[model samples]
Target: MNLKFTPLACLLAPLLTACGAGESDETPIAIPAYTLTVNLPQTGTLCVDSNQNDSCDAGELEVSGPAGARQLQSQAPGLLTSPLLFIPGDPAALILMHPAARQDGQHLTPSLLSSLLQSRIAEGTPPHQALSELLAALAPLQPNQELASLHRLQEFNLALGELIMAVLTQNGAVPAPPAASSQTRVWPGLFILLPELSRHFANGGDLLDLQARLEAILLQQQPRALVTASGVSTYSDGTDYLLTDEPADHPGQDASLKQQPLRYRKLDSQGQPLPDNASQWDCVEDLNTGLIWEKKLDDASSPRDLHRVFAWEFGPYRPTQDELDYACPNSEAICTTQQYRQWLNQQQLCGIGHWRLPHAQELMSLQHYGSLHQQGGQTATLDVRYFPDLGAGANGFDGYYWSQTLTPSRRLESVPLAVITPIFWGSDAGTDYPTAVQTPSDVNALQLRLVGEVTR
Candidate 1:
């Protein structure tokens, strides 16, 4: 392998006594520094580890984007620690590494996982070549070795996730490192239970039986099943689990990353901060996005009650009598989404006057896709802790939340559509994936969640 070590210039002339070279025949040899170019997936951070802590420190050479050059100061083979780590934009993205095998002009890609490839290099195969062989070897393993291959793959992913936790923690990110006890339960659960799953499958184990066992381990482990991607915190309900979109590193050339969970701060009616554990709050501020969201109330007397649904008054069609009855059950004057926004602004709900319907993307950001899994008959798509007032609609699923965006299709001008996202699913009902849907702006009785810009 070609090594790209750059030569260091001599500090002083050997003939000059002032340089301290005349007193000794020996001269200090400078350690060679290697540079590598990292190509990220449109977004992510790259850190060249100088301290070997595996995290990007304040003064470390760090870059972010699709591509950048980082200088690796340590030339030592990365037997134990990664010399370079590329953290992708997604919080759950598998941390890719420039394996320990130092090579010149090594074009490092995001698909490289340090541990497995490094292990191969320890056996004397070059990493680039080893990567190729490993990819080829991963293709459809023999029946006898299938279980073993799976176990190995899981181990590598877990090890890589541990490294990611270290990086996140060192950077003061939210995810805490998994405790040693968690690691203990996680590994043995995988090793012991996987074979059982395979055998059970071989013996005609039903899908529900396998699911129950897998769910049990996921629950019994509490957190860090070692299979769940890092960065996302465990939900109060163990049924909510986020499966990483990360492809097997050995076979896939590129994969999407799991993003860090969005941080939120609760606010009271006066726009004052509340403790995260606070049982009551009128609004939630997305710390990552700097957007504040309105919290629906449980009381029907309040205009912001979760049960009240409204039609978009600004649409081409007017609300039908049934729509008005559902939105303003007690014949409240404000029966439409526009009227609700006006009332909220007039009252300056949560001490913010600019509250308006959120864009579709902004509203969808609150959705927790992991909640799609069927568990305990709970089917809300958002974290109930932060957004406690989302209620089942007349149709029995979590009600739809209206967005300001209109649909792009060229339907009849009189039937213009507005975007809405389903916030809940009925047990044994609803689509497999929760996403935004377009409905008749004036006819659909959708709920509204307002968002506002941060006031600095």
Candidate 2:
């Protein structure tokens, strides 16, 4: 992005040289007034090859012409012109300006020109041919405004050329005259998918048009799907939960699949429901035909220190009633009940059991959309209809949930090979929100979410 210019005085020094001709009276020769037109690629570097390796191996040459104009020559190809004037066929010259090397051993090439063009098109320039016509009108010599102006124009052309080349190459639509050979090879169509070119795709032309083309290509060459499984139920337990038999035929015997009615009560310090609310707890049904969940408060002094516990007697696992309570504590003093409940369902807690803390990796897995920032914070919304029990009120909480796994700086002495834990944000959380957990110590506490897989 940096541009440097040489001063006009330095540019004029060589042109002012004393003319030496035959000692005798000989007529002075006039230089032909031929215009030099340099065609530059849209986005590549330019340089002169002192060694003639067909590569821009040498440093950029400082070029000065008629008038007090000077320019730093770039590896990128572009036209330079002398001030219009009558002169001997041969004129004295000096290196007044040169292109700065941005990196070591970097050179210019036709491909670089193509890349530059692609970038310009992505930036909203019209078709390549139209842009080329416009660029052709630029004069070789920039007025004395500054050398930077001239260099910038050159760089612009380089960028534009690169873009044109990229699009043409990607679609296999480039002209065939430029055939691949040992010294120069045509780039593969797939090169358009590179990260560098992706910027072009994201910003080039109409979004709808781009999306259609990309989707068509992707569908034609479907990528392999990646499937993953986690949770303790998937590990080798005493029994296979997936194969467990249930009472599906007999209504009365189907208690194994029936859902237990949740009990609500107002309690005092002694753990007894208030006198008026006692009936609320008494009405709770055992619902034993299906799995059973017991909601209880962990002993205040227990090191586990959780507010609520949900104990699942059967099925994969269930969030401890304590966990739910922690999420929706009865009092604001205990925790933000409203926020907690919203997070629970948003993170998919209704179907799975044993809502223990999620591991760090499990938390990160929720980010199926890949790097958040790179996508400009745009992500698809999640479907809430699947988990009707989560209820309609559980919305708008775009925060990170914690995992059962702890990300320890050092391995735990008790478990040497434990996997590191990370927090994951639900798709509903939105990419703009930060995904971090808060722990009791200097570290942060992590929230755990529950999930179960179903094959359809």
Candidate 3:
């Protein structure tokens, strides 16, 4: 059977729309309620006779409960609260209940819980309370292997918190509660505490210290039950939990290194450097490098500084002259642009896995403090000059670079221009600017920069 899961965003979209208007105020709106019911079909009789006689019975017979054979009857609709249910010989079902229905003696559904989570987070509900309730809901679902599941729950909680914080911060509000101490109260009720703990630390709290405490507790004693990261003062198990100090390394570093050198080299397959026509350099080269190089220069000229020259001269690395043959195959080559694009569409990269042009938001996320500039020829608020390797070779010096991601508002069917700010190696600041290149066709190029996070 195919399992279906709804994105948390979609499930909460309605609630989000409703609360969006009143979000400016500190007060949370009262949650609305609704009721939901589920009904199961009756089992056929032939199956019951076979169970009773231990043989293939052709005629129908009444099947009973654990005690004895009895008549089977259809069951009335029953209130459902859990997001998942496993009924013997029945397909699982999900029921969604609203707050108003719950108040009228109805139980909450998993979807309802998800909705509440989104709503409360939007309303800037205190993290402690939000986390507590989340934990209470998840506690009953704990699996036999507690540690791994606990870690996953923690990660999920952290991701949710981060998303909420980002939304709140974008809307010009404080993401966290005023009372820092109140965080302690939030942990006991939560099913997953690690993510919340991580969020607390990420938002400027002592998370490493807390992690150490948790490690110590886990090592000393193995607790039969999962404990929230927040209230990890003692362990139920006699063994102490200790956190391993080794940091998790990223797999992207190798890919980044492999691609970095390509930024500097010139010449197509024949060992011929790029022609000086400058005007012809627009979008004719390899989609990824060509786009990068095109965005780096206004019109090719002498290096304004080391930065421009470096970025311009360094990339499109060549392994052998033959390797360049397929670099940017156009109609003139055996593999046309359409063929290359189709091939690219088949490949996947980054955590998103599928490599495609990025949307405008995904592209802009690379922007750092280095991309800022000042008005009227004065130094910009942020300077890219601080970065060390931005424009060092063939790559252009200082200009906006485009990302593959398109803008959010653009229709998925209609490809839009996408770009990012150039990295200024001269200043040591690695900043990316958000920008896009307009395209007549819906077709867009796919370019990706590899980045990874180190989690302990």
Candidate 4:
């Protein structure tokens, strides 16, 4: 919602922009006229959309974190140097450059934090359970007590996270704890530190040292599923499938958003009444969004081919040992991600094989929270009639599905590219809904459901 700009030399973050023209001829050296944009997870578009079209249009960058999407763009700034845009007033800006950029990894903005936090809450994920998952994501940076200074700062920042979440809760509606647990718990210093942290994050501080500290301490909250802005791209296995997250606009107040609808259809045409027999393999269509989904998952009884998964570098690089072996027999001329597109153009399943992966938001739309016991309803984890058998863990055919959408951050050769994977169930419980993760790209562990747009 706010904007600031600095030289690219300081913070080498990603760029997202739209510009009219450059400086007049009087200027000898062309300086980048920076336009910094922050995508408010408050809307889920990750700030990439210059027009707020509910989609990432050209020139808009997607950022992750509880801070929403933060983007810096220039019309003529050459590749050599780009300015770093910071919303001093937005706490999410601190993380966008901090731990993720500091560790030379990825940073989840504050908007993303709210999305993860609120999504879990809305879907009935226990607060502690959701918090634990985020903490686990941060566990990789484990230093819970190593630095007294960092410990103190993290606690202060975490309280700020709570404060921001309160403000983000749909129309600022903070839920009261159940009567049974409300009396036993206490939120210490939560009120006292809110104003201080909010001010510190907003001002972005003049003390360079303070900026560094702000970045470091936020690691304490250590959230996961931190959303990121990604551009459109399709993946090709044997076939090209467009990928995206679940895109159904939820009606209730969620932390990641104020009042944006999924902007897409919630149910497919055939979803209302599943076939009584097992023969309904026809892809179903969501009239509103034009996205068609596979009726069922790949057969669990059949052996899986993990090598089928590939990163931009190509060749299912991160598969399980079993998958690695399976990928070995006569495997040459391995199809890189680029080559996969050619495959997709040729793929035609259900009389429509040119499928693509869905974005994280687009794909997430499939979850039927009503199916979860926590949601107090029973409709099946998803539109069971449409997406029957979206399994979980190492067992069933259902599990994490692949999305072709790429992150706003660059790939670090030292480590795999971080990406969001869609999951349907957590434990063995039949009632669990779905959730997502911002983890390294891996495929041997899960399968994918194909989705695409069909025109009559």
Better-scoring candidate (lDDT), 1 or 3: 1
Q: Can you give the lDDT of residue 270 in candidate 4?
A: 34
**Candidates' TM-scores?**
0.41, 0.19, 0.22, 0.33
Cα lDDT tens digits for candidate 4, 1-456:
333334552242232321222322222444556444434323223333233222334564544444344554555332112212212334232221111111122233332233333233322333345445544443433424221222234444454444433432325454442121121111212222323444554455322224334333332221112122121122223232332222234322232233222222323333332344545445665443446665543553322232143323222323343433333333524323334434544545444555555555556665544343222132234555445554433434244555544332323344334344555544432222222222334333335555665533
The C-alpha stretches of model 2 lying farther than 4 A from their native spots are 1-355, 370-397, 410-448, 452-456
**Number of colliding residue pairs in each model:** 11, 71, 83, 59
The true-structure Cα RMSD of candidate 4 reads 24.2
TM-score: which candidate is best?
Answer: 1
Residue 351 of model 1 has an lDDT of: 85
- Best lDDT goes to which candidate? 1
Residue 163 in candidate 4, Cα distance off native in Å: 42
lDDT of 1 at 184: 32
Mark the regions of model 4 whose C-alpha exceeds 4 Å error after superposition: 1-279, 297-347, 373-380, 392-398, 407-414, 428-443
- Reference-based lDDT, residue 382, model 3: 20
Ranking the candidates on TM-score from highest down gives: 1, 4, 3, 2
Q: How well does candidate 3 score on lDDT at residue 125? A: 32
Is 2 or 3 the stronger prediction by TM-score? 3
What's the lDDT for all of these models?
A: 0.52, 0.28, 0.29, 0.37
